[model samples]
Target chain A: MDFLGDYTLRIVALGAGTLGIVAGALGAFAVLRRQSLLGDAISHAALPGVVLAFVLTGTKAPLGLLLGAAFAGWAATLAVMAIARMSRIKYDAALGIVLSVFFGIGLLLLTDVQKQPDATQAGLDRFLFGQAAGLLRSDVITMMALGLPVLVALALLWKEFKLLAFDPGFGASLGLPMRALDVVLTGLLVVAIVVGLQTVGVVLMSAMVVAPAAAARQWTDRLGTMVVLSAGFGALAGVVGAVISSRVERMPAGPTIVLCVTVLVLVSLFLAPRRGLLWARVRARRARARLRVQAVLEALLDLDARHGDGHAHSEAVLEVAGAGRGGAGRTLAELERRGWAERRGDDAWLLTPAGRAEAEERYGGRR
Target chain B: MTGVQLEIQAIAAVTAAACALPGAFLVLRRLSLLSDAIGHSILLGIVLAFLVVQELTSPFLVVGAALVGLLTVVAVELVRGTGLVREDAAIGLVFPALFSLGVVLVARYTDSVHLDTDAVLLGELAFTPFDRLVAGGWDLGPRALWVMSVILAVNLVALLLFYKELKLTTFDPALALALGLAPGLVHYGLMTLVSVTAVGAFTAVGAILVVALMIVPPATAYLLTDRLGVLLGASVGIGVASAIGGYWLAHALDASIAGSMAATAGALFALAFLFAPGRGLVAAARRRARQRWEFPQTMLAIHLLNHEGLPEAAVENRIDHLDAHLGWEPAFAREVVERAQRRGLVRSDGAALELTDRGRAGARSSLARTA
Candidate 1:
């Protein structure tokens, strides 16, 4: 509570938190639409717009710069679409093209602005990898003002957006103007991305967009729950990132925030129910153990069937039935442990009647 | 351009060509973004190599970058194999993590080291000539020029030697597997070339230009031709053009050389997108327009032919009736008929339109084509 009492800390946390929610909500749509990297592309493309806006208006205001960024983001999306559609270059390549080229232009302009004697181009370079410490009260207010509308739009068009993400063809069939809805959604995504750029930066902003939604996806199946969870996770990462970077010497907040969200995503990937890697691994181990026990039981049943009078089978025979070398010993031991079979000496085993019945049932009584 | 400028341009061209060779295959395989990932992640390798060898000019730099570049691909594939994330997301996840690690390493070691993050992200081709390679106490021209030349040669030789294998694996990996070409090995080979080229180009043009040169040239070439050989040649040509053009542009603007090169490459791509002969935007648009114009004229002739002596022949054969009958605007209908008439496919007989013998023959062929 005392930590939160610091005014500057509170502002940075709020600003980062607001950014995370907006980016994460929009990122869910981007991720679902398989345009996860659109955030990256749009952010990079927004660089030139930011500089251009400053030059044109000569204003250091956040709103004006973000508006310029939105325009550039929209243009980049269009360029990517055009390149993908008009040429053989795929969407990913088109994305790369716009990203590097626009960023290059931005760099060139920044350098030019810096070399000029009269222009005070300080802090413009922060857009590369954002410095959250630079966030002002006005900037935070601007972000909230810009962000709330994007959130409201996303909420208002939740059903339509869901249809667009999950089943655009179905939405179109229902006379929903799916294409126009897509444009609006993309526009909203641009707005969300532009607002986050000053905090997370062009290089790492996409991670903010992708990681929260990705983590949320691990914990939920329903879209509404996922979207809500994603926003929360994103905000958590942002605040945590802001706190950590503030405490640590010489650590930039944007990448720190990105890494925080990435850690969340990795944790979710490993520990979430059903889809988690830990559960999958556990299930696999159980499945293998079950198969081995069944194999040993079947081998015993086969020996009993061949002898017709309850003869003990040697361990070598079990090995020959596909349990190679050491597997035969372990399989037999497991069977004995279950009272499914009994060892003759140390090298042989015979199935109990119960084991025979169970084996027959398992194999559909084929034997 | 001055001598120094010429040398810088030459270095840029060589770097671009080397990158473009592997880039062509990358574009074809739809693994274009993976190149970007590799370019970014190779910084880790360079930093590790520097830490180990304690020298910036060692051959191990290239080796280290190649190893990490390969690791980046392997790591991405491993993540993708888990079935959690798609290929693109996996790439996005892996590279940023490695890049951030590299950035932190550079930051931590900056006091004792000369590693400049700015140069890595944005290169300085303008200063390449000053960093001359001295071998056996003899000046061996710019270090960047020699390194890039060696890499360019290596790339060209590899592409030439494995041309068939590369082509087979890229266009149809399953067939390459059937033929025992070992496409996985070829894929690794191509990746190694990309890594080597990226590292070689790093000192001259930096990561941004490396990504640009690696992708844009081949993408532009894709728009220009369908043949792989022509595609390769066109990409190399475009790469050299962008390199030189970017050099002059940077000189004129007095900006960052690498940024200018990337921007130039982008401009070249834009031009190819609009104006490439077969598959460009302008070409596609023109083809669509021609089709639109010709289709209506053919329909008009066919309509006249269908009503040659029928009851509606009187109405349908009238040129003005075309607007109402076909639901076309009056001006558009008039234009179609005039075009047909100019081509000797139609004749007007005072308020009535009729098809000539040539028009009838044309209509029969159109019907045959449809049938």
Candidate 2:
């Protein structure tokens, strides 16, 4: 409770919240455009940029470093696109190439920086896995400055961005510069990614981009609503994760935030209304139940039609219909409960008038 | 290089080449991201297995890590199968979460000394030679070389055993399925091999850059060749070359060796992208440049041959009329005529153009090509 009113906690929370909102919103487009892995490649590519900025500038300004990260990430994505377009390399392979290669070069450079005789570079590798506790008020403001423009750009070109995400080919056909738009959109993504990199690090930053949007996608089909919900999920998870990590020693906020959002993803994946796993299972069960009931009713109707005057069948109906599994008796019971079948004797069954009509309609279609 | 240095390079080269074998198939199948996903997430497997075995050198740890690699693939497929997310999104969702769990576990439960998380991401290939595989107190070799040598052998055996199935499933999954080759089974098998290779290569390249070895060389090979056999062989060759080249680059710079190898592979890919003979960007651009002049000159020769001594021969064959009749930009037409004349394909007589004997032969051949 002592940490509740702490000012530093609030600032870190705000920084993480800003990260979530920007990354989540941009990530919605990335996921929809099937460029979810692009975020991973971009983040990995940002490492060299962050290190290079420090090596060149002899200063570690968050804004300048993020700009370098954005530039490097954007350039890497362009390389990925070029590799995919120019050669027989698949887009995924191209992405892997850039991701690994850029990170490798970054590592190579990071070590080179560390070896400098006058180098007092203490925490440059912190960007690799973020040093979240190092978040300053300026860092928070830097995130806002970087993130807010992307949001404003998103607002200004809502229709074009939507077209860019959903149907770039159609947008291009409509005389839009779809390729240029894609480049700009990717630039925006790189900015959003660098905004989060300070809080989430390179590897986990991609999870920040992808997880919230993926979770939100399970809850909505509309783009605007999905983006809003994704932002909410990201921000909620970010604050909670930052606070939890601050409370627990040795717990970094980036992975905590990643795991927290992962929990939301799993919850959404399994429990969201229309698209969730639970609903799918329920729908499957309902369909299976309906099929079994129909089969039993048809069996009863077939007996009536063959024996004349609603002739009855015994418990053998369940056997004949092959419904004798988990709900073997329940299928017949369900029919009787629906007043579609009735008990003729202790062990016999007969089709009701409603059941006969129901069976006839379905059975007629089959015939 | 001393014996130790040579051993290090041998391990690096073997690891690189072994990874390349599966790398070739992964690239061909267009599921190269699986390598990235598996590489990161297998850290959890190694860590969890290490907790149980308590011995870093235990073979069960390798098996456990490989199994976790398979689990990562299974988890991605399961998530993607739900239709809630696409494959890439599923990949993005699954690996980081699992990897983060691994990081958290390592951070919380384990000491940093044994399983340093930094070593997991950027492995210390420099220290790999120190961990010798001693038998009866005799130094057999570096443990990494033995691990990677077995993996290279496994990959080679797998490649030879399932080359047909892999090729069939890669280029034509529908036919592979119809032929009852069980492309799905082959896919899982390929994934298993990938997971195993990632585990074997994990100690040398670390979790992140194993993807570099597993994906980059084959991807570079893909640019150089179109045939699967050639692609696989080229991947191995390129991967080994990167390993050897990277060892020296690191030697020169005092940087991370694994990182250097990945960087070297990346540089190789960049080279192949620009200059691979048939399919490279430079090659294609050069081809276009050659055709720019060559194609139009052939057309000019054909045009001249068509109107030799005819009533419209002067009008049609005149260099001045080329812009209007042939729809050239006047400048382009003059350039074309000049190029043709320079090549002895046509001669200019006053304002009329005449085909030379060589020009007639060239025009006839052009016509024959069209036929």
Candidate 3:
């Protein structure tokens, strides 16, 4: 109870939850555009910007670091685009190249910064991987302030984004500024990523962007529903991770948050009603069972049709049906229970009127 | 060694080798971002290896990293199989979580770990040789070169052994499956190789440079050739060239070596995109312009052939038709006619312009080819 009552825990949870909503909203489109990796690339790329900003300003202020991150993220995006457009290299490869180069530069810059004699540089390392435990009230407020407008903007452009995602060519043909929309969407992703980095860090921020959207996609097909659900899932993971980490003496916030997101993704993969693995398996099983029952009924009908009014023995029918004597007896019992068959004498069974009608209807009125 | 001269050679070789092998597969598979994912996810492998061995220089580190890289592929595949998340989204979901886990572990266990999340995520290719591998008192500073060589060998052998299978599967996976080839096995095998290559290169070159190595060379090669075999060889060549070039550039500027390598690769790709024959931007533009110039002349010939009703007589009026299409500019039309005649497709018959049988055939063939 005391753990829950802690002000720091409450603040972290609130901040993470807000960031999650923003990330979830942006991630839905990022996933749809197949630019999920872009999130990872940009987040990692932002490191150099953070270090550079610190070098220039000589301060580890949130605003300066964020501005630096945004610049780096945008620059990485541009580099990716330039590589893709200028070379025969595909978009993914370009993204890979840009992500690696930018991040490497950032790492080198940070190493240089760390060598400097500054106490503020002491905790700057946390931003590299993320240390959500160190999040302050001002940080939380900053996240919410930045996150809310981005989420609201996404909401406003939800329909446009959906159309753009589903078919950009058609969207362009219909006079939509697909390029503008793309920029807007990419901008939103960058903002969400930069802000989320505070909570999840560069290494894991990509997961936060992708996991909730992926989980929500399992439960719904509609874009609006997916976005809403994804946001909900993200917030839930955020709150849960924050709470759990706060309870533990030494657990950091970022990994716990990511773990929570991972759990949600796994659950969605296995248990979602319409598209989950378990549901698909159950559907397949039911389909197979129905096919077996139908096959048995078809065989019985064929036997009746062949024998006409002569009433062939059940043993002969079982042989024709490719069932063993024991198997035949079990099928007979099942048919009798369903009122589809009746024992006529010592070794024969007859199809009832309803059974005959069912067989005929099911097998295209076959004998 | 002078920093500039030494750094250039080191960066160039590492960058070139890194990009060449993976870039080919990335282009073929169309999962270019897989490189990005592998780059980030390998951090987890490194961290995990560090934890188990408690030493950064353990041979087990490479193995552990390779295992983690393979784990990332499995995780991505598993996520993809869910069908809820698309392929890129699945990649996005898996690598970050693993990377985060790596970061958290590092933070918890290590004291002010210099290999931070960004460093792990991006790589340290520029400073790679600074960390030397001393085996039996031998000085092997460029450890990445050896690791990459082995990985490259594996990649080349696998590609050669399964050339036909890989080509068929890459061009048309469903068709390959229908023909009784298990695409799943090939896919898993390729992914495993990618993982091993990525992890092996990570320590020597750094993460981001590995990406540059994996993607840029193949892309440049793609621009220069249409044949798959040639493309692979060329990509590797381009990668190596860029690595060497970028290393030198970085040393010259005192900049990040990995960044310089990537920039070099990017510049190579840009050059190829602009100047390569057939598919190059300049070539394509030239082709388009030539097509526009010849179109009206071809159209005029077709019109004259339709009007004259005699294939032989059509040759005499070919220039007149060309003139008519351009509003009867005699000098230009005559030039066009002479050019067409020189190609053995037109003939002069006194004042009337006409086409030869060969000319008619040539016109038809050109039209068909364009269409």
Model 1 C-alpha lDDT per residue in residues A1-367, reported as the tens digit of each score: 6654477778888999999999889888888888888887898889888888888888768888889889989999999988898788999889888988888887777777778787777656667667688898999999999999999999999999999999999999999999899999999999988888888777778788888887888888899998988999999999999998787776778878887888998898899898889999999989888888877777777777778988788988888987553477877778888888887876878888778778888973664
Model 3 TM-score is: 0.80
Per DockQ, the best of the predicted structures is 2
Off by over 4 Å in 2: A1-5, A117-120, A317-328, A354-367, B327-331, B342-344, B347-351, B356-371
The worst-scoring run of ten residues by lDDT in candidate 2 chain B lies at B113-122
Q: Rank the candidates by DockQ, best first.
A: 2, 1, 3
Candidate 1, pairs of clashing residues: none
**Rank order by lDDT, top first?**
2, 1, 3
Report the lDDT of model 1 for residue B204.
80
Query: Deviation in angstroms for A260 in model 3?
Result: 1.1
Considering every candidate listed, which one attains the maximal lDDT? Answer: 2
Provide TM-scores for the models.
0.93, 0.94, 0.80
Give the higher-DockQ candidate: 2 or 3: 2
- How displaced is residue A360 in candidate 1, in Å? 4.0
* Candidate 2 local Cα displacement, residue A31, angstroms: 0.2
TM-score winner between candidates 2 and 3: 2
